[model samples]
Structures are given as structure tokens and as C-alpha cells.
Target: MRTTVPPQEKLSLNVLPSEVWRWSAASIAQQIRLGSISCVEVLQAFHRRIDVVNPRLNAIVHEDREQSIGAARQLDGLHRQDSHARGILRGVPVTIKLNVDMAGEATTNGVPAYSRRVAPADSAVVTNLRCAEAVINGRTNVPPFSFRWFTEGPLYGRTLNPWSADITSGGSSGGASVSVATGMCAIAHGTDIAGSIRYPAYVNGVVGLRTTSGRIPAYHPTTAQRFYGLQSMSAQGPLARSVEDARLGLLAMLGADTRDSTWVNAILEHEDDAEPVRVALVDEIPNVVVSDEIKKALQQAAASLVEAGYVVERAQPPAIDQCVEIWQSIAMTESRFGMIAAVEETGDASIMRSVHNMAACAPSVDLGGYIKAIALRDELRRKWNEFLRAYPILLMPTSCHMPQPWGADLGTVDEMRELVAIQSPLIAVAALGLPGIHVPTGMSNGLPVGVQLVAESFRELRLLCTASVIEREAEAGSALNYTAS
Candidate 1:
């Protein structure tokens, strides 16, 4: 792994007593274990950061400072008693998305009507973070029902992109990305059904990992049974400022849970020989008008990988359009049966408009059609799996266009159709249950730009290794330059 100071750390170094907020989760954990810092001091630094920045960003919608401080005190006592009591993420301050279950907290999911729907117990992800001794500072915001790409609703208002308020802070993980980018947390937990995790990270200039569907067990104790779309497509993962920190967060969240039947015990890392690996570089889609900036980002990432001992070739996966269609068919139809009524009744205006536009873009499907789409999705997954067998890593654009305007998804149905075409890269990977990571390259025209890397299911280690290489190059001049303003 390459070691270099990230742009965020460079800025933090100039300030007194506030540098702790910018340290990576790995560094924070090690420092706490070595008795260099107490959990109370670490939590205090983040609390100060939240107070200074969160008012403008609106990233962390819910906070429990007293509870977090108490947890930190208990952790400090444990560390004093047993020298080996440190978990992998011990003393690391983190934020959980509001959509997940947290005991005594409302899983409002950005819906005003559900503000009173408190969770009786922690979700599996929260339980894993607590087991890892991570301090949950607060709950981040999301779109209502987490159904839109832009993060804004009646409940939490909006999460501004630290780089530019005019551009979106991509959802449904918008707050997760913003919180991590602005140093409010070392790591932020995010959930991705479509591009929720990856897109938010892309726009906010952070690293987001959309793990394989079953890599991290997920369940919500406060909600009803999950829809089929969410069950097969949604993934729980982490967003952080660096690839190593993201890996640390992932390890802390992985474990077996009886609540989620889809949880897998797959090996986390694959053995590597000394030979160079093949990487398929996908810079353009057949019918998609990929912006020049996006293509340039992909080329730069590919060049970095080639210099790091990987063979890069131009190749496109099979049936990408079909994959998008199948994704929309299954996801939209499932929502129609399971969530439309609730959304119409309780969702905010933004979600109501975006959901209707999305439904209009999807081809109407009956029960048999939905089932057939699910079957076809498996076939597409097999084809992509075969493609990935030859190419261990596939480099592509995170989005075909640059960061969009704040309310881009609330436009006409035809506009949403166009948006979907540009977002095919994100949809295809989610549809196939593959693992992908968004690594920021640098800034372009005052906004962050980045590339996406996809690997075979359960091959996150490969993605992380490759992402670190590109990230080192990004350290030269990346958007981590943005400080909380």
C-alpha cells in the first residue's frame, strides 16, 4: 500500500487541537490502543467539528452527544483495565444513516410522519459497529424513503455538498458522504440500493464502497419486511475519506447475523501471485454521451493502474442496457406493490415527484413480468461474472456526467429517462450484485470527479488495492482541498 498524506490531513495539520478530527479511523484506533489519546478526547474533537460544520451542511440530522460521551467513558475504562480490549475500530467516531435501526432512536428515514417510529433494538449493522467499539456520534440524513439521488426532503431539509451547494450531495447516502468529507466523522455508514453509496461519495469527494449484497448482514427492526428489490439489490457499506479507512470500517461491520438470511461467510481476500493483473478499462458506452471530463477521469485512473503493474485494455461488459432494464423492472414493480401506497400517503413532495417520474420511466410489468426480470437478472450476472473472470478489475466512470444540480431528479419523466441512461454504470453493478468502489481523482470546474472500479463478488480486497493506487495519485491535487465552510 502507498502511504501519503491526504489533502484533508494537510489542511488539518495547520490548525491546533483540531487535527484529531481529520485522522483516519485506523490511525485513531491505533493511537487509542497505544494510550496516546483517550476515547473522550477523540469524541470531543468530533463533537467540535460537528458543531462548527453541521449547521451549514445539515449532514448529521440527529445527535446524542451525552450518550456518545458516556460510551466513550466506558470504552476508556475498558482500555485501562485490559490492554488488549481494543477493537479494530476502537475509539473511532462514526455516523449511521437515519434509515437504519438504532435503539431508542427513530428510524425516520427522512420522513416526518415516521419521526415517532423509534426502533426497539439496533439493526445488524449498528450491532456490528458497537461490537467493534466504534462511537456512534449521531444519525446522518437521507432522502425520504431513500428513493432519490438528491438528498432533500421535508424532515432534514438538505445536505449541501461541501464543494458546491448548487451541486447535489448524492443520495440516499448524501449525509453519510458529506459528514465524512467535512471531518464530522472518521467513517459514515451508508446503504446503497441503486447509486446511493457510490454517487454520494462521488459528488462529495470521498470513498464509498458498495459491498456485495450479502457481504454485510442488514436488517431493520423498526420497519416491515423488505421488498424483493431491496432484498436483492440493497447493500450496507461504509463511506470514508480514504481507502484504508473504508476497509477498516468494512471489517468491523462484517459478521454473521441470524436476522439476515442472506449473510455470507465468503473469504474477504483472494490470494495473489506475483504476475500482473488484467484490468478492463471502460470509458464509453455505445449510446451514452459520456462527458469529456468523465472520460478523462477514467483514462487517468487507467493510466495510474497500468503504471502500477496492471495491463489495461478497452473492453465493455455484455448486455449493460438489458441489465438496466431488468433493474428498473424489478425495483419499480416491487415498490409499486410494497411501498407506493405508503409513499403517496407519507413521503415528502420531493420524493413523491421523483418516485412518480421513476415509475413513468420504468416499463409497466405484471407479476409474471417481474418474475421473468428477476430470472433474467441472474443470467446477466452470469455473463458479467464470466467477463470479470478474465479481468479481475474493471475501471469505469462513476457517472457519465459530472455532479448534477441539486434537484436534477425532480424534472420531467423524459428527463429522468435521460438521467438513468447516464447512470447505467451504477445500475448495472447493483443489478448484478457486484462490488464497486468510487475513488476521487481530483476537482474539475470546482466540482469533484472520480472513477469507479468493479470486481467480482466477494473481491473487495482487489478493489481496495487498486483504489489505493489511484488514490495516491489523487493526493497530488484532489478535492479533499475542500474544508468545512
Candidate 2:
């Protein structure tokens, strides 16, 4: 078996303090557990990095440096009292998205009216992270109602892409992606209903995993109820620089909570069979104009998997166009019930325009039509599951085209329809409740480009393993290499 030393293992006692911020979460936790580095030192190193980089990117909108430092001190004391006191992610610095509940902090969701709506308690994901002994260093930004792909809003302003100003940072988890890419934190929490997590990671050149729905329990204490579309499709997952770090974050975040009725306790890993796995490569979609750059990236990823001893073949799954339409029909219909009204009332002009454009594209349906769409989703899932039985993995573009310029989402209804088509890859996976991840291939046109890997529900282990292979073969350099121009 091939092995490599953790990044921290290569550092000497006199190494530059700034370099500590670049270490992976696995490396940081391992070093902290070994007692060679103190939690205070790790937290302070990240604090300095945030101070220097966050002003330019606006990734982390809320921070409490003193509180994080105090927490680190407490963790250090516990580690001194007992050697086994370290959790899997002990002393690792993490950021939570602003839309999720963090006790005593506002679940702003990028609305000015809800700026004072402080959460009475932490959400399930937040509780799990705390239990794992990870330090919550800050909160990331989101679009208004977290409804747009661009991370600018009236509440916290815009989060700039570290690579280019003209390109979007990729929201509604844009802040999360930027924070991880720029070394503000080792791991960041994000949510995905459509392409929020994967899209941001693709554009920013980081790893974002959208776990199976209900894999990680989600609940916000401040909100009374969530629309069915949001409840069924939204997923909580981690964004990190490496697949190993994302796996560690996912493990720590998984736990049963009574608050979420949909939460399930499923086996995370399965024993590997003797036969090699097969990968289904999707380079193009019917009637969709996939960019040459993205198709080339997918072809490169397929080649990497083949080299890694996996069987790779060109194939397309069932009814991708139908999946996209069903997702829009159900989600848009449910949003009209209440979410649209709220957005219009509280959302800023950008989000409002984006939402209006999206609604315009969605097919208006009656209750019976909505129910039929729900039933059709099950049929699609059944077909997809049958397809996966033959090919355990699916490789495709994270988005049909490369990352677009900012304000693309705020374009006309016709433009928004085109944007939705481009995002079909992300939407189909989410709508069917499958596991998907974004792994960067390399740079093109001076911007990051990547491919998406997906597996059946509760098969996140497979996705992560495959992504690790692609990530290793590609060797796409760190997002930190790019200056925030």
C-alpha cells in the first residue's frame, strides 16, 4: 500500500507560523493529539490567516476570536487531564453557514429583517461538530433566504472569488467554499438543495460533499417548519481542501437526532467485493450545450479512474431531462406556498430578481400535478438505482459549463432557464437524493474547472474513495496558490 506523511509531520519546530494554516484538518488533529502543537497555537494561526485574507474575500462574516481562543484553552486543559480526551476532529477550526442555527447567534439566512433572530439552541449538525471537539471559529455568508447561487446579499455583502472578481464565488454556500479555499478554515459546513455546495466547490477549486439526504440530521430551532421541497432535498455536508478531510468531517457530523424525522441510521461503509468497480461516464446531456472545457475535464477524470484500475465507459443515465423538470416543478410549487412570499418580503433585489426568474421558468402545477411529480420522482429514483447496480459510480461535470460571471443568476427569465439547464447535473443528483462530490481537475482560462462523482444513496464512502483517486491523479494544486485579484 502507498502511504504519505501528513503535512504537519514535515514541519519543524521553527517552521513559519503562517504555514500552519495551510495544513489539512487530518494533519492538524493528528499533530494536536500528539501534543507537539497546542490547540491555542492552531487557533491563533488560523485567526491570523482570517485576519489577513477575510477582509479581501468577505467569506467569514461573523467572528468571535476571543470566544474561539477560550474554547481552545479549555480543550487543551481537557487533553492534559487525559490522553484519550481527543475526539476525531479535536481542536480543528471550522466555520458554520449563517443559515444554520448556532446557539446565541442569529440564523440570518441573509435577510436584514432576521438579523436579530438569534437561535435559542444549536442545530443538530452544530451540536455534532461541538461534540467532536471542533472549534467554531466563525460563521460564513449566504444569499438572501439562501436562494441564489451568488453569495451577495443586503445583510453581509458579497464574497469574492479568490481566483477572479468577474467569476462568481458559487453560492448559497459561496462563503463556505471561499473560506476553505483561502485557508480561513480547514472545514466549512454547507447546505445543498440544488447546487449550492457542489457548485461553490467546483468554482473555488475545493472538495464539497453533498451527502445523502437524511445522512446528517438537520434542524433549525428558530424556524417553525420547512417546506416539503426544502425538507426532502436539502442536505448538510462539509467543504474542505481534501477528500480525507471531508470524510472526517462527515463522520463527525453523523448522528441520530430526534428533531429530524427523516434522519436514518444507515451503514456508512460496505465491504468491498473482489471485482473491480465500474464507472459510468456522462460527458454530454441531450439537447444541452456542454462546454468543450467541461467535457474535456470529464474525459480526463474518466482516464484517471481507468488508470486506478476501475472499469470506465461512456454512458448516460435515465431521464436526466425529466429529473431536472421534476425538481423544478416540485421545488417551485412548494416555494410558491410560502417561501416565495417570504423572499419577496425580506430578500434583497438580487435574490428577488433571481427567484422571480426561476419561478418564471418552473411549470405551475395544481395539487394533483404536484403529487404526480412526487410519484414520478420515485420512478426516476428506481430507474437510477437499477442503473447504479451495474455501474457503481457516475462521473460527470459539476456544471455543464465553466463557472459563470457574477450577476449571471440575476439575468432575464430566458437566461435563467438556460442557467437551470446548465445546472442539470447538480439538480438530478439532489432531486433523487443521491451522494455527489466535486473534485477539481485543474485550471482552464485562468479559472478552476472540475468534475462531479456520484453514487447511490448512503454510498458516500464509494464517492469519497473514487474522488480520492481522481484527486490524487489530477494533483490540482491548492486554491491558496491563487491571489484574490
Candidate 3:
């Protein structure tokens, strides 16, 4: 419901910070509703922090402060009108990824090519956040087309990790992760094609969740047909400093968003929470090399879960080695048919770079192999389902290494190819269409590393529930460059 409130007017108030920037969305909302803090007050505090730290972080780029304050004021007015029940999100300021549409704002996806193009309507994800009563305060930075784990595009420049400017803030959700890590937003909206959300959260020392393919509806009016694997491999999700915040954000985002036709009504559940469920920890996923430091971080995380009364086992799943091939075919076909065509049509260098990568992979893939790859996808999903039936959560390295330097991983097409190769596990796992969480556990060479947790379809509650166990026990965080005041 639109309100008649003016953008300039606000309920003047101030609230002191309860503690560090580690506040969760649930806790912040509770505090706002309890009148311990006003919506405007909390919103302003975050804004101030962003202004102070974002120069170095470059997490949040474009934002509508007036609109946000106005929304907060409207919520305040509503709360006064009816204090019986607070809204879904009473007073939480959030950052939206630039790749997604927001009404009357440009959805650039960090392309220099479309920097001036503005979206005519809000995306399903954005609409859902508004419905949940979250204040849309800022638009985060994303790589060109939300493609890579390092956040940099000719349009919005670069989004450096708050942990260290030297290392990358994982993309395409890299900006969102940086925003949350630096306290710019309580929760950030992000999308994943391969390891976009998970990578950023892994690098920024935060938590990121990738909803199942249908679990969160993704739509863009620009294209009539979405590439097959790009259609199934991609998802929109939340990035936060804590698992509880991830839970709250995912709950608000899950549902049938009419914008996407494939969305299903898959409700979340917690199966037999009375008895602790099994968790599988995998440090090896075939091709990727898990660094010794990264291995230590995963082991430490596993030990913490064991201490928390959950049965933690060191094991690899059935057919994990074949995942990369299947994933490569699925991803390559989407690019070969879609992205390659777009690049050839435009002949733009940036788009051409994307095409070149696809063309390089095309020759290696067989026509029949692609078809069989599609068939095998079903079997892979089945294996994950059966595995989750026994072990509700699977823990593994979010990536094999700590956050890479901002431009270290993607300078050349070869380098970009290498990144995809290294992160094959994440891409393959995401294709199964299950909910997964990437929780920052430790750092190496002063950069953050994380452990990933995967759960059954629409079973975000279980993923978050299991994640909470490791989050508290392993108090590890990403590398942060704390400036002296």
C-alpha cells in the first residue's frame, strides 16, 4: 500500500549503537519495534557508517537516502497507528545488488555499456524486500553482467573487500558482502550464477545463501529466453554478517513471485530438530586444490560443529568428481547459444570477451555430451536429495583459497577461465537447485576464507539452523583493514 507521506518529512530522533556492526536483522528489527530505537534513527546510523567507510570499501555506490528515510517515517507512522503487531521488517536498511531491477532506477549490472539505462519497474526480489518493510537505502556494485567473483566493471568501478582492499570482494554479490561486512546494511540482496553470492560472503567474512533455482524468482524484461544453464544455475539470495540474518532475509524472500513462471510453492521445514542431524565435511572436490591454511579453517569449523553436539563426518558424496564436467557443459551451452550470439550481434569488446570465453569452451564440448549432461543433471540432483535425506547439511570449502587480490583472478580471459575451473564445485553444487550457505570461518595471507553448507530444496531453515551451530562455535572472520580513528 502506498502512503501519502512526503519524502522530506521524518520523525526526528537518534539511537545509539547497541554494539558493533555485528547486529543481525532479527535483533535490529526487534529493537526497532520495541521502541528502543526509531526506524529513522537506525537507518541514519547505518548511513553514517557507510559514508565513513565506503570510500575504501566501494560496496554501496548509488542510493536514495530521501526515499529510505521517507519509508522509515511511513513505517513509524504506521507503528504509531497500530502498535499491536510490527511489520515483517520494522526498520532494517538494506542494499540491493545493481544487477536486479528497482523501480525507476537503472539496473546496470556494472556494465559500462548500460550505465545510463534505468529500470522501469522493481524486480521480484526488490518488491519482496519492500513488502517485508526493509528500507531500500543503497544499490551495491556488481561486476559486468554479474559474472565474476571479483567486483569490478567499467560503469561502477570496483568493490573492494572490507577485510582488505588488496583482495577481492567476491562477485557478483561482492558489493553486497562488502556492504554488510562494513556495516553499511543489515542485510544485502545478491544473486549467484556460479559462486557469486557464496564467493563474496566467503571473501568478505560474512554469510551468503543461494536459494534454489525456483525458490527465488529471477526475471528481466530485456530477454525473451534465458539460456538453459544460466536459467537453472542462477539464483538471488541474502548476504549478511550472521546466519540469523540470513534466515530472516531468506524467509522474507521465499514465495511464488509472479514475475517468474517456474517458481514453485516449496515451503521450508525442520525435520526432527530434537535430534541433531548429520553433516558431511568435504575438503576435496576433485580438481580444486584446498590450501593448507584453507584446510585448517575447514577443520576448525568442523570441530566446532562436533563440539555443538552434531554428528560431523569427513566424507565426499557419490559422483562429486563428475560434477565439474556436467556443470561445464550446462554453463558452456548457455553461454555458447546466448552470450555468444549477443556478443556477435553487438561486436562490442566487453561482450566479445564473454563470447571468446564461450567459444573457447565450445570446441571441447561434444554435441551428444551436452544432451547427456542435461540428463545427468537429474541424477545429480537425485544424489544430493538422497544424501540430504541422511545428512541434512553438507559442509565444504566455499572456495579452495582465501580472497584473491582485486584484479588478480580476472585480468585475462585465461585467468577468468581458471577461476571458473577452480570453483567448479560451487557451480556444480548450485546446479542441483538446493539452498546453500557460505559462512566466513578464517583468513589466509590476511584475507577471509569460508566453509559452505548445502541443504535440500527450499530447506533454507535447515541450512540456517545447521549454520547457526558452526557460526557461534567458530568465531573466525575475514581479514579487515581497521583504520585508526
The top-ranked prediction according to lDDT is: 2
- For residues 183-260, what per-residue lDDT tens digits would candidate 3 score against the true structure? 888889988877888988887788899988878877755435576666777788998777767877876676567778
Predictions in order: lDDT: 0.86, 0.88, 0.73
Task: Please identify which of the two predictions, 1 or 2, would achieve the higher TM-score against the true structure.
Answer: 2
Clashing pairs in 3: 149-171, 163-479, 163-480
- The per-prediction tally of clashing pairs is 0, 0, 3
Give the Cα-based TM-score of candidate 3 against the true structure: 0.89
Count residue pairs with overlapping backbones in model 1: 0
Tens-place lDDT per residue, model 2, 210-310, is 99998999988998777776678889899999988998889889888999888889888776522349999998885579999998888888888888799
RMSD of each: 3.1, 2.5, 5.6
lDDT of 2: 0.88
Tens digits of lDDT, candidate 1, 1-485: 32222212422223433479878887788778878789999999999888888898899999999999999999999999996755888889999999999999999998888999999999999999999999999899898888888998898899998888899999999999999998899999999888899999999889999999989988789888787666888898999989889988888899889888778888886556223589999988755899998888888888888888999999989988788898999999988886677789874677888899989989899989988998999899889999999998999988899999977888899899899988889988898888999999987887889999999998887788888889988842333345564
The CA lDDT at 62 in model 2 is: 98
Q: Give the winner by lDDT: 1 or 3.
A: 1
| TM-scores for every candidate against the unseen true structure | 0.95, 0.96, 0.89
Error of 1 at 3 (Å): 15
Provide the lowest-lDDT 10-residue window in model 1. 3-12
> TM-score for model 2?
0.96
